[model samples]
Target: YMHRPAFVALLVVLIIGGTSVGTSAKKAYNYRMRERDVGKSDIVWNNDEYVLLKNGDINKAYKKIEDELGIKALKISVVPLEMKYDRLEIREGIATIKFLFNGQLLCFIQAKNDIASSNNVVSDRKVNSEIYNIWLDKQITIERNKLSDDQIEYSMYLSINGAYYYLYGIMEEKEFEDIVSELRF
Candidate 1:
């Protein structure tokens, strides 16, 4: 009957949608892998697939980094332009990203290596270099009656190599002041 064709078309649409959803989930997995790989470092390249937003101003770059990462920064002082050598293995690694927002002092990142072999490949467990990443579903709840809803929601990320640890949280609070004070840059 005429209805048979419509039913078959509906089935096809469902199949396509399911496949698309699966592909997106796979992409998310790969993205997490990439984030763990290119953690905070001293080399000057952003292989760590980030969503970039630009509005023709350098401050756009500063805002982009802060908004995406949800970290606080403090712009203390600007250094005069000077030529410096980049010895890190990372290709075109950012030597210095000079900007301060929130209260994070000397908030800049650099790459430590230049292993840019797999630019387009989707990350998979089969790939040997995938590092351990934080669980997305799990959140560390801070039990503070004084804190607001926004303050209670935080996640801790352990570095891939376990060199450093990070916690993303809101500013305008005293809890993070101690950590921010220790930053040298």
Candidate 2:
């Protein structure tokens, strides 16, 4: 009975304090790692575009995209317009680019193939024609479709090249056009 209540209170305080300190240290370490990762990329925060790709070579960038997306023979180029993006991630045949402004989602870009055939409809006639054109080395098809309200989808089907690329996101019509205008190849 030597100050039993006091000893119990002290023990509780020590446990709580240790837990908080550990949590804080972990958070700080994660923040440092994120900063380091961002530094390794070819992005300068003060620049016009948030993601300024190194060397500005679309073909090289496309290879990176292909590896990330697990796709084969992806031959295309894109030059993004001036815009701020929060982060970009590519994993499991998908590339996601997220744009944020003041901690709010402005828009995003998702690039992937129609692997599940859920969004696209393909017929025998279309396949036969595509094959013929590919044999002739004229199998490049670029199409743009406007989805329901503030959403647009741009597709570039490279039959001969054996890859299909799509860009779709929720953004202003004018802004979307600006981005589409920058696409090359």
Candidate 3:
């Protein structure tokens, strides 16, 4: 059921997409600390395909990421007791991974140094104090809106280990706070 033109177009699109993905192919990073600080570290902030991390242990994955990226990678140190958190991964960015919880894709976690405007890739809407609170006495910028009667979208920013992290996706507010509280430097 494919016309000649349609088949050719599909082939062209596949080739283009495959080519782009190839450019960002997975690479292994190693740490060799010198006099360089976090700000001056040479981290490849490039997009990469998902990699299954250290048996899905976040703490183990965090340690591996820190060692590999040659930076102080952030950790969701304690992944809310007994929650199904077997899906964790890391790319070559500000400590990023595709996080899953309770058999659902929770959000994309990204951490980078400094609170630069470039990092505000999330929405500009900010949630009020009633819906958000300062965790660990650290200021958190939040934006949330109900996507439907049962689903709420959340974009939250917080500082940890001298780097800024933002979580963006649809998840329960209570679940979000538990993860925030577990963030350790």
Candidate 4:
């Protein structure tokens, strides 16, 4: 009787140990999958609030973003803004969106008048190029002056991802810093 009891107890210990190991492995797998899913679904930048010219289809992305934000289709006429450095094609109006973090977001949608036309069809390449150039010039300036150096003089830095989509216009360093600071994400 004593021997049998001991044998049963030993068997129970081995079973419990095996079950514990299996459960631990299963838990680990579950945790890893959850983390991966979160990473895959991460939203890096805002589309509607910010002027995002993504690598994907610009019109499709713009439409979807516009609908999501409940914003109307932006009809713009480009206005030539004479700056100290160069003449820039500025969007006639500025759209302000109250974003999280007590921050105000400013989006400039180029007006039709501001953009030059070749044959009445708006040239996307031209627009993209103009924006990109402007973004680059601004980035260089921002890099030269660190944020800690002057908070008042801080210029917005254009999101690198956004700049990639519109790579044509000349950007002042001050403008790039200003844009980057405005971005929430």
Q: Which one wins on TM-score?
A: 3
Worst 10 residues of 2 by lDDT: 123-132
lDDT of 1 by residue, 1-185 (tens): 99999999999999999999999877665633233224543222232243221111333444443454343322212221221112211123222343333433222342222344222212211211112213222232221222344333222222222122233333332333333333321
Tens-place lDDT per residue, model 4, 90-114, is 2223222211111312233322222
Whose lDDT is greatest here? Answer: 3
> Who is ahead in TM-score, 1 or 4?
1
Off by over 4 Å in 1: 32-48, 51-185
The TM-score that candidate 4 achieves is 0.20
lDDT string, candidate 2, 78-106, tens digits? 33343344555675555545554333343
The candidate, 1 or 2, that scores higher on lDDT is: 2
Q: Each model's number of backbone clashes?
A: 16, 1, 0, 36
List the candidate 3 regions with Cα displacement exceeding 4 Å: 1-56, 86-89, 114-118, 128-137, 159-162
Error of 1 at 67 (Å): 29
How high is the CA lDDT of each candidate model?
0.33, 0.44, 0.55, 0.32
Native-structure RMSD, model 1: 17.9
lDDT of 2 at 27: 65
